[model samples]
Target chain A: MRYAMVIDTLKCVGCSDCVVACQTENDVPHGYCRDWVTESVIGTYPEVEIELRSERCNHCDNTPCVRTCPTAASHVIEGGIVLVDRDLCIGCGACIESCPYDARYRHPEWGTVDKCTFCVHRVHKGQDPACVSVCPTNCMYFGDIDDANSEVSKLIAVRKYKTLAPEAGTKPQIYYLI
Target chain B: MIPFQISGSEEVFISGRNIPHIDPHLTLWEFPISLYLFLGGLSAGILFFSAVVHLINKEDEFKGAAKWAPIVVPFALSIGLLALVYDLGNPFYSWRLYTTIRLESPMSWGAWVLLIVTPLSILWVMTYIRELFPVIKYENYKMPFLYKVEELAVKYKKYMALALLPLTIILGIYTGILLSAFNARPLWNNAILGPLFLVSGLSTAAATIILFAKSHHERQWFSKIDILLIVIEIGLIIHLIMGYYAGNEMQIEALDVLMNGEFTTMFFGLLVVLGLLVPLILEVFELAGFKVPVIIPAILILIGGLIFRILMVEAGQLSRILY
Candidate 1:
């Protein structure tokens, strides 16, 4: 069963609680993040509208990070959660180079490549990711795409969703609702 | 957490969260490590090239290059490996580079290439060492088996030359491809980089030959080759710069960064002037009626080539306009 996060940008408050939750849950290094928020303002003066984008590993169906990693240290898991094996990672930064989204980072302490694992450690035990659980505005939806009754599947059926950089051909599992 | 400042306009925000973005100042550190890698690979490839050509032609003028190529290529490669290790935070775990093979990745290709070429090149050198050094030929004691191997190298020099040529071309071009793979990074995504790197390999290879050639005849012939390589390199630079100029805003911005931003001085001062210009001027002098030695120009060109790689890598990484 594939798992994915569908983020509704109109519903997002830009609170950064998800960023905090993901970092604390994963113990990610300083100056590096598995999840990040970017804000873009369109138009000038009174007509301006703010667009917020939260980015992480797309958990691509055809992951470029895996293709670019010299060692099999970076690979996609069963749910298509692209994860890095810290023990096997040489901290070469090649995966970082290969990733178009710039979702991964070389950890200062671990000295290995690290990225969003979809909180796999938590998801493996049948729980929502820290970001999904902690999100105050209910902007994040996480569930198995395989289950027709799952919340994510139901949301995908009902909502208009889009993926970032669709031209990249990676088939990102993360869906954004505009 | 900083607020956007617009002149002659009141502060306006539709949402509670402020728009925050990284300043242009925050970029990946200009790590000098890649330069070492590029230079080492170029030097090794060039030396290997010189070795192959000299081994085939076997002219008296090319003998010094033939002898030095085997010694110098491996040494430069060893130094490149050391530089890469030094750049790593965990050098001990560098072995992990060899643990996998993802053909699509340049690093993966490079890692495997290095792994195979380094040892093979070293063995290739060892196979010819006794011939290069007369002292090794008449050592106090020698094995008959070793003599048989030496006989083999002499017999198969043509085959070894053919093998080393393709390997050298691959080594030279792969570095350029590594930089070009980052398509999002427009500064480095140019197709010309492969040819640029090929010329760089030739340029540095000639520099190395000039640095070590013991005989006047060998030095003169190599200097001619070095001068030719330098000319070709200048032509490639002009072509690349023209491409950069005529491209889109991103490419133009990148060129601006190299021509007028923080990296401007280094790019023009070190890479263009010290590296390319001075060396070219010196070569021109020798080509004209001047009687100066080629040693100074060779040294300048060598230093220039090293600095050129460093500047290109740094400028490319630092000038990224991430949206």
Candidate 2:
């Protein structure tokens, strides 16, 4: 199943609750984060416009990280979720350079790369990811996009959305609804 | 309405709570990686030229290039590999690199090539050990095993040269491909990086040979080759910059990092002028019977070669496709 995440820019308040939820759920190091909140302001004075986005790993279909990994430490599993096998990872940092989103980080403790796993542990237990469950505004939608009736698929189908760095040809799974 | 007017200029500001390495700049690869690339390229170039001289049966006339030069490859490669391992976050798990070969990965290709080439270089050196070390007689030292191995190596020396010819080229090109494979970095995404690095590697190797080749004829021969390689390197640099200038917004921004940003002075002053241009003129004049101290141009080229890799790694990391 091809899983996807759809985040609505209009609904997000840039509170960064998702970032905190991800850190707590995954036990990410204190100084590092798997997801982040971005605020962009455009134009001048009266014509100014603002956009807020909560971003994370796109879990790209054509994964450059996976393609460039020498030891096959980075791979895609069931549900199109990209994960790293830390044991196999030599911590070469090649994957970090390959990622346009800058999603992955070298775990200082494990000495291997780490990134958002979409809380696959919770997904396997038939529960939403911690960030999705903790998001007060309910701006983030996560589900199998291949299933036509899935919430993520339906939201993406109806909304005017864009993915980050589409020109990168990675076919990112995260859709940002504007 | 207020008396003062608000600026009508369009402005875009982005604020992200991204982590350190991912946000302000990519500090993932550091000086170790730069040194690794430089040394790897140097080793490749030495082996390439040495193999070519051997294959052409010029070993008698160009003994420095064919024999003495290759002895440095093993040592250079060892040091480069050490730098690579030192840069790794989990050095213990580095052995996993050989468990499988991912054909699409330039890194995998490099790891495998290094594994094979390192041993091949040692074998090549072993064949010439007797000549290199005249004082140490294997029979007197009771190392008949080494003597036998050397005899076999000499017998298969031509075959080794044939094998090394293509492998060295791959290793040289692989140094640049390692960076260029990352599409995330605009400055490294260009295809010209492969050939540019290969030529730079060859030029550096020629300079290195010019430094220690005892024969005046050998020094002059390498000096002439370095001059040609330098010209080609300049041409490649021009095309690389021109390509970036004519590219999309991201590429133009990458070009700006080299031309008008933090690396501008180092790129133009150190690498272009002192590293390449100065050495080019010195070598040219030396060829015209001028008494140019060979060490000056040779040392400059070596330093320039190293600086080029450092600047590329550092500047490429800064020129991301997205902020």
Candidate 3:
């Protein structure tokens, strides 16, 4: 089963409720983040188009980070959830350089590469990911993308969507519906 | 838990897994990685030249390089290893780098090469110590272990040189591969980097030998070799620039930094003109039987070689796709 997160950009108001919830649930240290919102202003002021994108690790099938890591500390699990084994990480920062999305960060306290795990621990208990549950608009969907009956797969089948850096050939699991 | 203010300029202090989505112009893998690349290339390049000289030149009339290559390569490699170790800073988890070998990882390939080459190069130098300095033989007494090591080195020099050739090539080219494997960095993803760094390594090693040559004939031979490698390096560099200019949008963005951005001075003035081109011209003149002193070009090439490595490392980090 390939788990994925599908985000509906049109429904998001950028209130950052999910961002706050993620922090509280993960107990992440300050001055670092596993997910972030990027703001972009396209076109001139009169005809301006503003976009807010929330991004985290894509959990790619062909990750440059996984390929370049000296140790196998960065690995993909059964559902294609990329996780860092902090016990094995040497904090060499090679994976930081290899990530095109700039998704991962060094944990301020532990000095190990850290990123979103899609709340895997909570998922095993049959709970929604922290960010998805906290999103007030209910714009984010998380489920097995491979399961045609899943909400995430259904949302992706009909929505006009896009993904970042397709040229990178990483085949990200995250999808953004515009 | 500071929220994103409407306007932004400062970095945020994120509380959890989330931060504002933006790729800051962050530079990763700094001084230690650069030092490792430069020293690794030099060490491997010197050993490669040493092996070639040992095979071709039967008479050891002027064998300073043959003796120095094995001794100096390992010394340079050890410093690079130290730099890498310090960069890691987590000795506890660093051992994992050796326990698992990922074939696709350039860093894994590099680690194994270093572990093998360090001792092998030392052995290569050991075989020749008696020839370089006969004092060990002239001394009245010698330790049995020391004598045994010396005998093994002399006995196995030919086989070791043959064995060391392929490994030396890997050591020289591995630095470029290491950088290029980071597909996120546009400037470093070029295939030309492998050959470019290899030629650069060879030229730098040639310059080093020229500096240390005890006889005029040895100096002239190494100088001639340097001229060839330098010329090839110029062509490869130009190819790199042209390839970038003709590449896709993000790739061109990387070139724009080296071409016209803040790095222009260091890229054009320091690395291109002074570091590489000046040395090339000086060596050309000397090759034509001009009266230029060997040390002048040798020193310039060495300085240029080091600066070239530093600029590549910094510039590649500067050229990020996300930023």
Which candidate's DockQ is highest? 2
Interface RMSD of 1: 5.8
lDDT of 1 by residue, B1-323 (tens): 44333232222323223312122222332444666556655655565655565566863557556666557677778888787776664567888777666778877777777776776566566666765676775346756576776667667766766777777777777777777776545677789988788787778778777777777777767777777887888898889989989986667877876888877888788878888788777777776658867778777777777777777777776544233
User: How well does candidate 2 score on lDDT at residue A62?
Assistant: 94
Name the better of 1 and 3 by lDDT. 3
Q: What is the lDDT of residue B187 in candidate 2?
A: 96
- The segments of candidate 1 whose C-alpha lies over 4 angstroms from its true place after superposition are A144-162, A166-171, B1-32, B127-155, B215-217, B319-322
Please report, in order, the local distance difference test score of every candidate based on alpha carbons.
0.72, 0.90, 0.80
Residue B314 of model 3 has an lDDT of 85
Summarize candidate 3's per-residue lDDT along A47-93 as a digit string, tens digits: 76766667788988888888888899899988898888998888887
Which tens-of-lDDT digit does each residue in A1-178 have in candidate 1? 8989889888887888888888789886655667877566766778877767677788988776787777788888787788888778877666766665767766778777778899898998999999889989999999888899988888889988888766666688888887
Q: Lowest-lDDT window of 10 residues in candidate 3 chain A?
A: A36-45
TM-score of each: 0.85, 0.96, 0.92
**Weakest lDDT window of 10 consecutive positions for candidate 2 chain B:** B1-10
Per-residue lDDT of model 3, residues B1-323, tens digit only:
34222222222322234333233444656787888888888888888888877887733644757765456777788898888887773655777888989888899988988889998877877776677777666246645577777788778888888877999899899989888888998999999998898888888888888877778888888888888898899999999999998998778878877888878898789777877788778878877888887788788887878888888888887786642
TM-score (chain B) of candidate 2: 0.93
For model 3 chain B, where is the 10-residue window of minimal lDDT?
B3-12
For each candidate, the DockQ is 0.35, 0.59, 0.45
> What CAPRI-style quality would you assign to candidate 1?
acceptable
lDDT of 1: 0.72
Off by over 4 Å in 2: B1-18, B137-144
